[model samples]
Target chain A: MGEFDLIQRFFLEGQGRLAAGDEVPVGIGDDCAVINPTPGMQWLVSSDMLVEGRHFLSTVAPERLGHKALAVNLSDLAACGATPRAFTLALSLPRADEAFLAGFARGLFALAQAHGIALVGGDTTAGPLNICITVMGEVPRGQALLRSGAQLGDDIYVSGTTLGDARLALELFRGTVRLAGDAFESVRRAMELPQPRVALGQALRGLASSAIDVSDGLCGDLGHILARSGVGARLEADALPRSATLAAQDLALQRLCTLSGGDDYELVFTAPAARRVEVAAAAALAATPVTRIGRIEAEPGLRLFDAQGQVLPLALSSFDHFKS
Target chain B: MGEFDLIQRFFLEGQGRLAAGDEVPVGIGDDCAVINPTPGMQWLVSSDMLVEGRHFLSTVAPERLGHKALAVNLSDLAACGATPRAFTLALSLPRADEAFLAGFARGLFALAQAHGIALVGGDTTAGPLNICITVMGEVPRGQALLRSGAQLGDDIYVSGTTLGDARLALELFRGTVRLAGDAFESVRRAMELPQPRVALGQALRGLASSAIDVSDGLCGDLGHILARSGVGARLEADALPRSATLAAQDLALQRLCTLSGGDDYELVFTAPAARRVEVAAAAALAATPVTRIGRIEAEPGLRLFDAQGQVLPLALSSFDHFKS
Candidate 1:
């Protein structure tokens, strides 16, 4: 397909999920997208890079690649308590294949429209598959959450269940998971198209002391919060929320993968004990469950505990961009 | 050096020229960088992708690559009449080499500081050499210029000299241009780091009817403005600005390179006929010369003219991302 035709067919079509506002003065087709600033709100912008064979396998579907690319960036905006407004994509492909660009743009527009975010200006270049998305959102000054704001004694919470996709990864690696069955397909879909909790994050802006998105496993990502906040965390192993998919896996292996395997894309945040009830209720209203997995402490190190309170030493492991 | 040290030694030690009001609240060293928006101004955002062997040669210097990556995006923001503030760099390298990253970061930081922009957040991944930069700037509401805003009878102008870099490219390709001498080195530098006319762009915000940065050669990029504005242009070959470097080359070959060769990164814009004197003065004050090379016409096609006022049929060739 021609570039103009491809853009019109995939991107110009209205997205039914999210509402567009006056601030997005120009969306999609332009040399540069224009956004009218809203009173009392400041724009928060962040960008993330996803490289083929590093972030995902070459065999991964184009649709999932598109979804995950925007999802990961949205997670960053969510961590900052910003409501999505618009984004620009810079995509590099070996070739401009009609089918591949169509599916990719379709997936990106779907997620962007779902969050009321408009696709702005971007560049397409010929190279190895490299997708970089810069997302912009609005947040009230001094109200946007930060990782350095976590206070001692604050409770740590995570949205959705952990270790679900890690278990699915194991099944696929072992050649036991088949995409033909509905259940297997669902599990794989969950692993591939993990949603970023945008609404829930916005709601937590005032309640949460600090926040982060769990792109690199919970342990490694939370450690970043701990280091930045100058606090420690004690996670309750028994309180950890493993999905039913993990419960079906080998117990020991599931526990290990849950702590080390990356690509969860969930938000891990810290809130005061006094606001726990309010935060929980908000998560419930959003239809996303919250798990109180840990608490912040004075010391600057992470520790895990079993049901009986036995100490469980954890390895500092996650997907390190350089090492991995 | 390790990843953390590489970040600290290169990225954290700022070197780029930053324009006023481009301070980054929380820069490198954190999990994510934070930018404090200038109140009362809407942010203008744009991104560009440059790939080795596609956009540049594998032999291009690391520092030049770094400069071009940010400069090109800054040019986009300039086209929109935004004062550049900050930029996020997503670089995919084949490996983690300290020397290369250090020089690259130095070049980028130099430009950032020069333009009063800060190095915000970005991702570093492993892949073929690719650089994508998302730059953010601020412009008052309803003030950002656009290519669609051009009106019939608008006087078209281009900043600085064009085709200089294209002639340099031809010389370099022929292996006749020795880089050992200072003059040849300057020519090579011009090819490597084509300045993005940021100041002229900012000044033209209220003065110009519409503007676009010339990256894909003058004829093609100007065609974008004409097509979008639903107007035509009559460009004078005699009025086209050519550098001494270009004038030294075969005249016909120089014209072809200037008109069709890409990667100029200069701003081409149109203004009301009454504003020409003021625009020329403003361009002089900014130390960037401007030439009225063309005029917007009521008809909807481009026409070129020779010094003798003879009509030269437009060649209509340009760089296309999808075209091989």
Candidate 2:
């Protein structure tokens, strides 16, 4: 697709519902997307790299890859309680084919517009299929949520179900799933186009003392907050949210999947007990459920407990890029 | 060099002076850098990618590669007349080597701090050596310099010497130049650490009618301005800046070097005749020289002239990533 067509079909439409903005000052058509920052707001910026055969399977659909790339970065902004504003994409393609770019741009702009983000400036280069996206958002100063902000006795909450993608992957690997089938399609869609909790996150700005996006699995990513906040956490396994499909599998396997599976793109956050009601109301308004699964403690460690209150030691920690 | 040591050595030291109240809110130690955007200032965001064996040779020094990656994006901000604030880096490495990363981060942070920019947030992944940086700067609304703003009779100018990298690359390829020698060190430095005229660019906000950063050779990058501004340009070759070393080379080769060489990272901007004196003053204060190389014409085309005042027909255009 030509640049303008690609942008028109994907980006310029359906962007009004994401943020609190009306018209984008400079949208997808310009060399750069310009936005008027709300007064008293500081722009929060983050970038991510997604490479084929590393971040995703080579056979994965191009549209899914595009969606996930932007979704992952948007999750970062959500974790910080920043309202999405604009983003720039730098894409390196092995070859510039009209079909591939069309699909990719469609997937990207779908999510971007859903969040009211405009496509800004980016570089196109020739190389392997690698996408680097830098996203910008605005948050009130001293209010952007941080992992270091979790305090002891805060309630830990996570949005949506965990282990969804891992279960989908298992079914695909076992040859028991077909992407065309209704049940299988739902699973596949969940794995591919997982929505970030942007609205929930923004509403949690002051309520949630700390937050993180669960891209690298729940236990592992939660560990980051605990480490950064100099606190500990106790997660009750019974409180963890898992799909019925996941629960149907072996219990041990399901627990393992819930703890270690990556690519969830869900929001994990912490708030004081007093603000739990507000958080629940906000989640209801966003139409996404919030699950209270654990609590922050002053101790410096993480523990998982069984329904009977027995402590369970994890054989392996969460994902590490270098180690795993 | 372990990851920690490399980051500490290369990224943590020798940051330059900063303007008052311009400290980075969240710096290199966090998952992402946080900067307090000046109230009422719109953030200008841009990202660029530099791939190994594509944008530069494998033999190029790590330090230089680090600098160029950041410099190119800074050039984008400069094009918009934005003052540097903070940046995020996403780097993909074929292998994790402490020395390489140290040198790279060192080169990156040195330039960042020099411009009073903070390293905010980025991702590190495994792949071919690729560096993608997203830089954010602040500019007042409607005051950003854009390539689409050029008008007829606009005097086009370029800052600093051009063609140095191209000449230096040729010498290096021929084994006739060495970086170790003092005479060639300056040339090597020019090629490696191309300075983006950030201050001059910001100062040109009100004066410049249009602007662009010269990353992909003058002719190719200038073509972007022409296309966007709906105007043409007539460049006088004698006005193009050349290094003393390049001046000694074959005149035709020197001309070609300036015409097609990439990675200059200089500001090519247009200003009205009335603002020429102000532009010169801004250039002097920034410690960078400026030369009037061309003028914007009402017609839509590019023309080049030789030192003898003879019109030269361009046999070939500069680099085109898509067409090439």
Candidate 3:
């Protein structure tokens, strides 16, 4: 198949054929997709690229890969307290595999429809498998959440009642850990699918002082917030959230998985201690549970404490594409 | 080096560190770059992906590769008569080659600065070499050009007086053609460095009925305008523009290069026959020479005629990444 046929057959047919509206005066099939920005809104743009073998295993299903590709980008928007608007996907595939394109489009559009976002435009080429998505969103002027907004004495919280299952699944796949049947399948799903906390991020816009999504592990990701906001953090390592399966593991394993387990798309945000009640209310409104695990400090270094308030000297590094 | 350090050392230091202004309030380092669109101006967005061994040869310099990667995307904006604003780049590299990156950034930022556009945000990963750029521009509402706006009696025109040097250079590279030293270098420059007709596109905003960038060959690209506008075209084959280097070649080779020469990032547009003088004025204002080579027809099929007014039976096809 030619590039045009592949796009027409998979992308420009169903879910990709979104109706043009006030926000998007022109969608795909044009020289460029056109957007009419709302009067009082600012556009939020985020781009994420996923490469085969580096970002995902060769064994991943095309449908799941498609979902994860867009999910990661949407996670960026959610971190900024932006409402999803539209996105463009630029993909490089080795060939025009009919089954792969069908499955990928089905999964991609499924998630797009769920968020009410449109696949406005993108490029399709022949090469090694690579997916690059640029998502555009809207946030009210002066209301966007930023990593530089955390204030001293602010309470640091994380959305989702459980996390770290994705890393656990990855470890299992690498044969470094072992799980059986349903347990393995459940954790594998966590590795394959992550829900962007878009609603929670928007709901915490006025309540949360700073925000970031957990992609490069909780500690490393939160370190960004501290560095940008010109503050430090005192993390209660024992209070870190974890799945029931992870919680049942050894204490060290639990800490390692919860603290340095990347791929969790949960939102890590900070709010004033006085607004703790309101933060809980907002979490409830978004139907995403939240737990406080730390606090911003005036000092300029991150410190971790155990249940007994004793400092734990555990070194953790986030996933860096170039380094390792 | 880690991803953050690589970006900081190269992208976020100078040219990439575009100051936040009224248009972009928050750029790189944020979860999502925020854009405050100008009121009454619609945003035009285009994305292009270049993969190694597919879009260009492995022998091409990293700097030239960087230039072409962005120029192709800007050509789309030019086709729409949109003024360049900002762009996001998502790059995947096999390794952290500092030299390659330095050269690429130099070429990329040079073009970006010339266009007065900012490198707002992007993602970097470790994988096969792939560059995906999503460019955002702006044009006055309802004044932006489109392929569907061409009228039946419109005269077709193309910017850049000399064309087909890119294809000639490619053929020479493949050892299918030969040229003298200076001539070869000149055509190679044409293939490596394409100047997008941004000024010409903007100047023709109200005059041109429809426009498209000739990336996939003039014949094929013009077919897009015809199909979209529901019109036909009578192309004067002998009038097709060609560089002196290409014109000196054999007639068959010259015709093939000029008619289906992909990589010519010039604008092919249509305008009312009565607006010939105005079109010439716009071309003069932009300092880009243009040639009238065809006319739109009410029929629904493209026809090519030689200087003798006889139909030419040329089997022309554009470059298709997949089919090729």
lDDT of 1 by residue, A1-324 (tens): 345334443543233112224666655444456677667665667778888876776766888888889999998888877888878888887776878777887787778768878776677766788889988887776677788889999999988875557446635745754434655666666667888888888888788998888776788778889988999989886676776666676755455556655677788899999997899887977778889888999988899887889887664243332132
The TM-score measured for candidate 1 stands at: 0.91
Model 3's alpha-carbon lDDT is: 0.86
Best by DockQ: 3
Q: How far does residue A177 in candidate 3 sit from its true spot (Å)?
A: 0.5
Candidate 2: tens digits of C-alpha lDDT, residues B148-218: 88889989898887554654564565575454465466666776778888988888878998888776678
Clashes of each: 14, 2, 0
2 or 3, which is superior by lDDT? Answer: 3
For candidate 3, the per-residue lDDT at A220 reads 86
Fnat measured on candidate 2? 0.55
* Candidate 1: Cα lDDT at B74: 86
Best by TM-score: 3
DockQ (Cα-based) for each candidate: 0.58, 0.53, 0.89
How much TM-score does chain B earn in each model? 0.88, 0.86, 0.95
lDDT of 1 by residue, B198-288 (tens): 8998888789998988877788888889987999989886677876666677766566666766677788899999987889877976788
